[model samples]
Target: MTDGASRRLLTTRRSVLCGGLGTVAASAIGMPMGAPAVHAAGRVVKISMQRSSVLFTVLKVRGTLAERLAPLGFEPSWHLFTSVIEPMNAGAVDIHADVADAVPIFTQSAGAPLTFYARERGAPSAEAIIVPADSPIRTVADLRGRTVGVSRGSGSHYVLAAALKRSGLSFADIKPAYLQAPEGAAAFEKGSIDAWSIWDPFLAFAEAKRPVRTVADGTGLTSYHRYYLVNDRFVAEHPEVVSAVYEALSEAGRWVKANPEAAVALLAPVWGDLPPAVVAAANARRSYTVEPVERAQLGEQQDIADVFLEAKLIPRRIDATDVKIFRPSTVKG
Candidate 1:
């Protein structure tokens, strides 16, 4: 969007939030600039996503990040891909934002150097088992022997498999209908599949448009969620950039929590064509926590890695500790 358009939408968003919409106003205001001001003295970087919210957050400067990055010549350029693993595997993007649980699968399956950096707190059960509103799949175990939709090798796919295991079932117990996000959503609408496992915006979009009901999400059935990941070698060389990105994301998390209503308003334009209530609901469920990587977190990732390895989800096991890089003190403005 042009600077004028972006700012106008931003202003309108603030108004929407302030009108007792319940979301806090965007407090990180900066003098709006006209054009991309990222001609700084650093290497230009490309961030990747599979149509997830973090990708939107990065490019739109959707939250606290806009202010924190205002100082750095760090303008964002978005790169879209089918899955977080593919882009990082190809080494096409320098920074990759993904679910923390997914790190073990790609990094260990392939020698991908992406490491867990920051996390999106309050992870919504967005990526849940969605059955057609009229479907007979009322319980998790009901998913057995049914064809479920998921993207092969994506985080949602992994989570769905993990969810199934909790019911004492495995991939062998059900039919996994492999399809991309859009295709999967469409298939679910047609009742061509028993259920669809997916993440938001798409999850919200599907739920609103189809006779679907959420059967599982990021909760008791599934606790592992996504985390911001940076290229290992890239972060080692450009720690400052890594730090800047983290600080910005941390701030964005704060802003999202503080001003959810405004955040949803700003999100509306991005998702204008979609259902507003879905956006509002999904936004409220998103976990936007900002904390430095801790050993406990690494241990959690390691636990995921072990599960994926046991399931042979990834090609091999990954030593998560070797890649859980963080420098929170330096990631500040």
Candidate 2:
């Protein structure tokens, strides 16, 4: 079916199942009958995501978001995009999940009115600087003057920068080939780039298909924490919906951790029918634990902003914690 038509169908299904509940909820919350329902009755929560986001992939595949949000009165709509920060900055989506921490720094610098609601713990090993198994590049230091492929503004981008610095080198020490993960992988396979810095399941996919060695993972470099964000206006107008989404995602994270095998089975097709083993490997490296966004947790983000500023990647320096953050009272049990 066409994308628009499919979304309409999902909305219809959600309204039919939860319409009455939303009205009751609205009344309970002291909202007038003429006012918008607590569940957002006719509103659809457009979630912006990418295929690489395993938690979102699982939630989308299971189709549980609709049921979970039915009482809250919001219909879930999924929008696939290449980059989370771009679409969010353009006002294309109300919410975005699985965006790397570095992306917000750039988006904020660009004046996008975005705010953090939730974050996943650091999964340093999930991203890495990879090289062909037999390549002469044996260390991050060896990358000097060599071409390294990385997706600009991604978590891996920061990982690469930090890796270089840790090696007593800087971005100017090497030539950077800015490419998306898929293109970077193809380029790496074609021997056009000396190394490909990327995150899973692409990392897992490449490792499964070919022999590659990790020069360095994010271990001592970056936190690799993914953030869940929403437009500033959305949070101001519909804080409950934002809360519901954070709770739903937090629950999904728990489910994935508890049932790794099932998560792999469900995510395999969404991830292009990837081998269950590869999916499992990728999932294993990820924390899959969601938590509320905290200022203390943003130290690395500040560091990322500084790094990008130093490299002139972002237009200006930004205070990572200057943006809004929604902290709901109750954590999901």
Candidate 3:
């Protein structure tokens, strides 16, 4: 993609901008008719969200983010994606709702011009290595020689890798089936795969409907933070949009935690009409506390990058603290 083309892609449009990725584009939330035009002139700010990002999805569905951006003359254009890493890296989107810690590491290694603005604090229990309920894989060690399904470069992938190392095994000990969530779930159900490394709400969904057992979670393996990011170009051009997004995300997360029932009711339908109970269960495992990303907090990210590098999963080594960070106004230096 040319520099001009990439810039154009980052700038939003009334119509679907980038297609062919199975992305479901939601209608652009236009500025209110009487709203004051502040900085930009009703420019659309493209943001991508996955169902796993509970707070982001809630904010999108409830129009909280749209409301926040409207007064600033920025229309919020929401897009549904199973993973936002690629689109953000390609500069196809302006803001990434949230992606796993490992994702940014891989993106950084690829030299994607991305900046971390906010993060959902560590929720170590949200992701795990799940096995058949009756399977004899009693421990992480038992996973050796087993077929394990994982989303390549996901936080859960790092969990599986870390778990294996803790148990005196390496990533090569098992046959890895790199599958997305749907494929992994189906393969796990068919008994074609011995185990799956997955995260909520998929983790909650699997446990609710399938006979599965969690062998190990990220308790001591990984912090499993979810990061909110934006393309570097977007950050440079519209720092106000970035701040609006950060504040909205932080508020949305607080709302979800404070009003669990109402939040579950709102998110259940968005998550393909999942049961409220399941939604609540998934939400419980996640820490919806959004905070600014600081250099000191990047220790684990560097560790994740090193691990992926040692395993040859990422193309090159990355210094996790090398990227830019947008400090929200609420957070003082």
Each candidate's lDDT (Cα)?
Answer: 0.63, 0.77, 0.78
lDDT of 1 by residue, 1-333 (tens): 688876876664454223222222222121222224344454465665444554335435443444445565555554544445556666677777555465455665687766667766536476677898888888779998999998776667767877877888888889989886767766776678898888776777776675677788757644545677787787787677777777666666677678767776666554433456877777666676766665565665565666677777776777766765666555453
Q: What is the lDDT ranking, best to worst? A: 3, 2, 1
Task: State how far residue 190 of model 3 sits from its true place (Å).
Answer: 2.1
TM-score of every model versus the real structure: 0.79, 0.86, 0.87
RMSD of each: 7.6, 9.7, 7.7
Give one digit per residue, the lDDT tens place, for model 3 in 1-333: 567754443342211212111122332222221112134458787777665767767776677777788887887776656555567668777887588888988788878888889999999899999998999998999998999999887899899888888899888899999887656766777799999999988788778876888999999888999998888888888888888888888888889999999998886655556678888899999989999998898999988988888788887777888889988776777
Error of 1 at 255 (Å): 1.6
TM-score, candidate 1, is: 0.79
Q: Assess the local accuracy of residue 173 in candidate 1 as a C-alpha lDDT between 0 and 100.
A: 86
Overall local distance difference test of candidate 2: 0.77
Candidate 2 structure quality by residue, lDDT tens digits, 1-333? 567766654553343213111111111112111111234365687777665666776666676677777777777776655556667778777887578777888788889888889888889999999999999999999999999999888999999988887789999999999886666767877889999899987788878878999999999788889998898888888888888777778889999999989998887655555678988999999998989988877888899988888888897778887878889655643
Candidate that would win on lDDT: 3
Winner on lDDT between 1 and 2 is 2
Q: Is candidate 1 or candidate 2 better by TM-score?
A: 2
Residue ranges of candidate 1 with Cα displaced over 4 Å: 1-42, 55-74, 122-124, 330-333
